[model samples]
Target: MATDELAGVQSVESVQSETTTKRYPVAPGVQLNVRSGPGTGYPVVKVLPTGVSVPINCQCPGTTVAGPYGTSNIWDNIANGQYVSDAYVRTGSDGYVAVRCG
Candidate 1:
């Protein structure tokens, strides 16, 4: 997908909270591992399947990986404070695509 295709998924200022929830899909054939924290050192809490569009609440610093969105240390919070690297997420921006998860 084109880079701009992921742009404007949602505007950060549109929300009134410190963090916002937005939907993003798991890359095809990719089963994204959800972690308890922002890095590999954290426990794997869940595994997301391909074709699933989940609501990412926010993001936090983590290990960088070359994924569909290129390299980044950001991790997306899908639910229950679980994280998955933003590198694997096609979040449009090459950097922090969501508000930082505190």
Candidate 2:
């Protein structure tokens, strides 16, 4: 391939890598709820299947919850308008694992 074409391919690969978010495992055997907002007070939008992993787009403070990991107020934004309590996700940290949501 020509040098320019190679450079273009490399640039595309770099962008793709940066956009690929890491998926975190949910607590074992739990059908976790996906809330509309960051807190439990928000309505449930969906329920994650047991043993499913989720990619956290961002995190924000929310209602405190206790899960297998521990109690926390951090909520993970898996998708637009979809959130799950960070306490249920094994992000290997008791704090925020991604950028804070706006």
Candidate 3:
């Protein structure tokens, strides 16, 4: 392929990686609650099945919670208006993994 074409392909791959959604495993044996907001005070929008992984779109601080991983106030936004406690997510860190929600 021509140099320009190869460069374009490489550029596309770079963008794809940057925009790709990253999924994190939930704590074992837990049917996690998906809340409307970043806290327990928010109503449960749904429940995630056991052994499921979730893509955290963003993170924000909210009600502190204790879970299998540890205690934390960071909530992961899995979708629009949907959030789960980061404490239950095995993100390998005790702090925010994704960009803070705008």
Candidate 4:
């Protein structure tokens, strides 16, 4: 392979390694309300306890619709590839969280 090609591969590998993701343990015993939407009015789709580490898929800022929200906030099926919100997963046992791939 050419030297340029080798350099490109190394660059890509370094970038991928530098980017790290985080997980959070769902609040214990508190069956967190998985909303169908980002906000409360969206409806409680399901609930799960703590120790369930969900991947932080994407994050959205607080809007008038989803009041009292904050950073590392609202997550959804569609996300900006940062933090995750409760709406990013399906309801019920063994539900899996969504991850932003791209």
How does each model score on lDDT? 0.77, 0.96, 0.96, 0.46
TM-scores of all models?
Answer: 0.74, 0.86, 0.83, 0.41
Model 4, poorest ten-residue lDDT window? Answer: 62-71
Where does model 2 exceed 4 Å of error? 1-11, 14-19
Models sorted by TM-score, best on top: 2, 3, 1, 4
Local accuracy of candidate 1 as per-residue lDDT tens digits, 35-86: 9988889999889888787777888878877787677788888878688888
**lDDT (10s digit) by residue, model 4, range 1-102:** 999999999999998865654555554444555655555556665665645665455433432232122223335433232222543333231333344333
Clashes (candidate 2): 0
Residue pairs with backbone overlap in model 3: none
Task: Locate the minimum summed-lDDT window of 10 residues in model 2.
Answer: 14-23
- Badly placed stretches (over 4 Å) of model 1 are 1-20
Q: Could you give candidate 3's per-residue lDDT for residues 1-102 as a string of tens digits?
A: 999999999999999987798999999999999999999999999999999999999999999999999999999999999999999999999988899999
Per-residue lDDT value at 26 in model 4: 50
Lowest summed lDDT over 10 consecutive residues: which window, candidate 3?
A: 14-23
Candidate 3: global Cα-lDDT?
Answer: 0.96
TM-score of 4: 0.41
Ranking by lDDT: 3, 2, 1, 4
List, residue by residue over 1-102, the lDDT tens digit for candidate 2. Answer: 999999999999999987789999999999999999999999999999999999999999999999999999999999999999999999999988899999
